[model samples]
Target: MNVPKASEKECIILTISGRVQGIGYRRSAQQKAESLGLTGWVANLENGDVRMVAEGTPDQVDALELWCRNSGPRMARIDRVEVVRQQASGVFVGFVIR
Candidate 1:
């Protein structure tokens, strides 16, 4: 994917479903986000979904999405990914597994 020259940070909320729980999805997501210089947190939902809130440049966000789709984890089987863009808020310091 082509990296976009982003001037401002972007916020995105990603909802991942399908065999997300009990896998290393959250850890992998946190590592991926941190490597891309993103700030966010990842958590497992009660309904067997994984939720992530991330903030970074468009390119970084796109990379994270691509990684999630391609290789979430060994035990994860991603069926769907829902992403929503929102106004950026520079509140988080680093990516974390929650």
Candidate 2:
């Protein structure tokens, strides 16, 4: 069985769609998350979406979400951002682009 060793309450999984791929979204998200002291990864989905999982304080997570909603990299046009809250696994060390 796979289980988290520690339960971090502030964690989020984001599915951001629309003009998010091939436009530095993953890298920019990584930088933003890292700067916010978040731990997790951002990657491009095969279906032209961007997926991000981040673990941090509620404020940090909110900040990241706000960034995604309002100000992604200049080139990206964000259409829909779906946010899912989950218990953090405390498994990541730093933010990265997957």
Candidate 3:
């Protein structure tokens, strides 16, 4: 995936779908984001989807998306991922699983 050039601080909302619930998707995401020096939160939506908001440079955010697609924990089966660029909300200090 081509990484877009973003400002020094920016946020992107990503909606992930597939067999992502009841697995370690949220935790894995949190860990990965933290490792990548990103600030965000990931949660499992009631509709069997995973939602994440990651703030960082475009490269880091894009890298997280790439990792989530294939390296999501052992039980996750990610089918599709939808990402939307957005302004940073500055609500989180670290990556969290919510």
Candidate 4:
């Protein structure tokens, strides 16, 4: 098993389902993540879901997650949000849409 260093930032993978595609979900998420000083990527899945990987301070990640769960783009009708926490990779430079 890979142990995370105590100094490492927190990371999370969010899977959002329902009416998330073609509605600027990725763009909105990217902007939000950037605003929170997070580094990661958001992308559309073939199964009509949106996936986002984010790394930042715990507070920052939590804020972003709350935004995603409580409020998203005006056009997005999110039905569910699943979050998986993981060790931060320290590889991303900035948030991006993919």
TM-scores, all candidates, are 0.89, 0.90, 0.86, 0.91
Model 2 error, position 87 (Å): 1.6
Q: List pairs with backbone clashes in candidate 2.
A: none
Using TM-score as the measure, name the better of candidate 1 and candidate 2: 2
1-98, model 3: which lDDT tens digit per residue? 85334445679788999999988889888989999988989999999999999998877888998987778888888899998887666666888888
Worst 10 residues of 3 by lDDT: 1-10
| Tens-place lDDT digits, model 1, residues 17-46 | 899888788988888898888998999999
List lDDT for all candidates, in order: 0.86, 0.88, 0.85, 0.90
lDDT of 2: 0.88
Question: Which candidate number maximizes lDDT?
Answer: 4
Give the per-residue lDDT digits (tens) of candidate 4, residues 1-98. 66344356889999999899988889999999999889999999999999999998888899999999988899999899999998788888889888
lDDT (tens digit, per residue) of candidate 2 on 6-90? 4544789999999998888898999999898889999888999999999987878999999999998899999999999987888
Q: Candidate 3: which stretches are off by over 4 Å?
A: 1-7
- Name the regions of candidate 2 deviating beyond 4 angstroms: 1-9
Flag regions of model 4 displaced more than 4 Å: 1-6
In order of listing, the candidates' clash counts read 0, 0, 0, 0
Poorly placed runs, candidate 1 (over 4 Å): 1-7
Between candidates 1 and 4, the TM-score winner: 4
